[model samples]
Target: MWKFILRRIVVMIPQLFILSVLIFVLAKAMPGDALTGQLENNPKMDMQTLMEIKEKLGLNDPLYVQYTRWINHLLHGDLGLSYIHQQPVIDILAERIGNTVMLAVCILVLTYLIAIPLGVISGRWNHSWADKLIVGYSYTSFATPLFIFAVMMLFLFGFTLGWFPTGGSVDIQLEQGTAAYYINKMHHLILPSLSGALIGTVGLIQYLRSEIIETKMKDFVKTARAKGVPESRIYSRHILRSSFIPIAAFLGYEITGLIGGSIFLESIFSFPGIGQLFLQSIMQRDYSVVTVLVMISGVATLVGTLLSDIILSIVDPRIRIE
Candidate 1:
């Protein structure tokens, strides 16, 4: 397992390099840049001043030179400056990433807690009313768009009922570190977290239910039943255990989504997370911030995939990493 993890880490180096190149090229190729947007809005800005600003930003440099400089700084833990915010890219990300991580963790926990057992039960009781109800819920949840769900939730819970704040990570008026502040923070988290979790839960439930049903048909399960193993033990030790392999494998992708946060949901909820930050950076053409965020996401996805593979290997002795 350790060797496999090391190999995966080594493999990520080249993938990260390629990802950086693609992100940098695409960002540069975009029609408008931060400077161009600034110049457009400030048409009276003198050419001399514009040239100086471009030089300062290394905009006049060759593409390779700029990329080289950016990579060098990145290796030294400098994420460069956000043109829009005039702050270090890392700083901006730092402020937002915690919120995104918090939101993602909440969504992940809620999704698993709600989806897994329900899926198992639905599969075990196939054709029953409970199974039918779960199936209906899964389909409905999957069919509904995330943005629409978020809006409806906000309208119902925020506007009409006023049970929670409509948006933001916390109430600005609340004193930080106080009980009111933390309570308000959790209150703000509920809608956005539920929005993401509901969307995620549908797919998980569907997958796990299918896995459980399939695993129940395996020869091992039939053998266990023939041996008169306790029904609960057979289900838990054999069926559910085997069913988890596929779910564990898929968890990698889910982890990536959770870390990145849901862009539409975050935007609708006005949550200060990496998703909203990414959107704002794109609008402002803040390539430094955009590049860092993309790189982080890509790396996170790769790591998650690796972790999933390791977990699968651990859970299923039949599977081995080369």
Candidate 2:
């Protein structure tokens, strides 16, 4: 098991290396550097001053030189400075990443809770009304863009019925550190979380549904049914357990999708998370922040993938034994 884990960890190294290189290269390929429009609209600044600032920031340097410096700083645990925020990229994100993670976690839990049961029931009773209804809902979710859903949810929940707050991670009007405050925070999460969960549920539901259908046809399940095992037991103990392999394998990808999708929802809801920061950074041409943010997301994906592998291995002893 240790050896398997070690091998997986080693594999991540090259993957991250390639991702970092690609992220840096693509970031540099953007239309202009952070200093492009710095003086264009500023009447007080002159061309020479702008040029000097560019020199200081190594904007005038060759691509190889800039990449070397950036990669070195990255290796040394420095994520570089954000031109827009006027702070270290890490520092700016430190204040905001937690909100994004919290939101992601909420959506993830909700997605699984709702998706798994629906998938199981639909797959268990293939061609039934419940299955058709779930399939239709899944198709609709796939068809609708996340941002549009977020806007609709915001308008309905935040305005029409006035059920939930539309924006912000928490309500400042409430006393901090109190039960009401935390509860209010969760309340603020409901609209966005629900929208994200609905969209995120599609893939999991389809995947698990297929797995369940396939598991039902397996020899063990056939034997269980042949012996007149209890229906609930055969469904849960036999079918569900066998179907978990696919769902378990999907864990890492599920999270990566959530964080990536958060960018759209965060903007629509005006949530102060990394997704919002990432958009702002790109508009401002703050490639430093963009590069770092992409790398962070890449890291999350790589680590999550590793976790999923470890989980599957632990759960199915055959993987470790092999």
Candidate 3:
């Protein structure tokens, strides 16, 4: 396991380097940079002032030189400065990464809670009403756009009935620095979390259900049943463990997808997370922030893939790493 992990870490270095190059190139190819947007916003600023700012920010350098400088700074633990905020990009990302992680955790928990049981039940009673219901849920949730779902939720809870605040992480009234504040924050989190979770649950449950159903049809399952093993024990001990392998792999990809998808969801909920920051950076054409964010997302996805491989090895020892 240690050797496999180390090997994965080694592979990630070049993978991340390639990702950095891709992100940098894409950012450059975009119609505007931070400077372009800045000049547009502050039309009063003359070309000479803009030229000075560009020089200071190394935007005046050749693209390759600038990329090399950025890579060098990354190796030295600097994420560069945000052109818009005038703060270290790492610091800005650090502030919001936690919130995004929390949201991810919430969505994951809710997805698993809803998906696992539905999947198991669907598998257990293959052609029954429960299976149909679960299938319906999976299709509907998976097919719906997250932004549209968020909008519908906001309309139902916020605008039409006024049951919940329209947007934002929390109400300012609960800023008394007490448990009440935290509780209110959690309350406000419910809608956004639910939106993300519902999106995830549909896919997860369907995948798990398919895996479970396939496992149930296998020789081992038939033999176990023939040998008079209790159905519950067979399911709990054998089927669940066997079916989880595929589910685990799917979950890894889901982690990466969730972060990527959160951009729209966070904006809809007005949640102050890394996704929202990413969107803001894009709007402002903050190349530094954009590159850093792209790198972060890339790293996360690579890590998820590595984790899935590691877990696969652990679950089935036949997958020994070379």
- Candidate 2: list runs displaced more than 4 Å: none
lDDT of 1 by residue, 1-322 (tens): 7888899899899999999999899888987777776777797977788889999878999999999999999999999998788899888888988888888888988889889988998989888999999999999998998889889989999899998888899988899989999888998998888878888898889888998888889899999999999999998898888887888787778888776547787888999998998888898887778888888888898889887898789878999897
Output the TM-score of candidate 3.
0.94
Which residue pairs clash within candidate 2? none
Worst 10 residues of 1 by lDDT: 257-266
Each model's C-alpha lDDT? 0.87, 0.87, 0.85
lDDT (Cα, tens digit) per residue for candidate 2, span 135-175: 99999999998888889999988999999887898977899
* Decreasing TM-score order of the candidates: 1, 2, 3
Task: Please list the residue runs of candidate 3 whose C-alpha ends up more than 4 Å from where it truly belongs after superposition.
Answer: 173-177, 317-319
Model 1 / residue 82 / CA error / Å: 1.2
lDDT tens digits, residues 1-322, model 3? 7987898899888988889899988988998788778788897988899999888877879989999998999999999998899999989988788778888888888888888889889987888998998898888887898889889988887789886666777678776679988788788778788888887788778778888889999999999999999999999889998888777666677788889878988898888888999999888888789888888899989988987777777776666776
307 Cα displacement, candidate 3 (Å): 0.9
**Candidate 1: where is the Cα deviation over 4 Å?**
259-261
> TM-scores, in order shown?
0.95, 0.94, 0.94
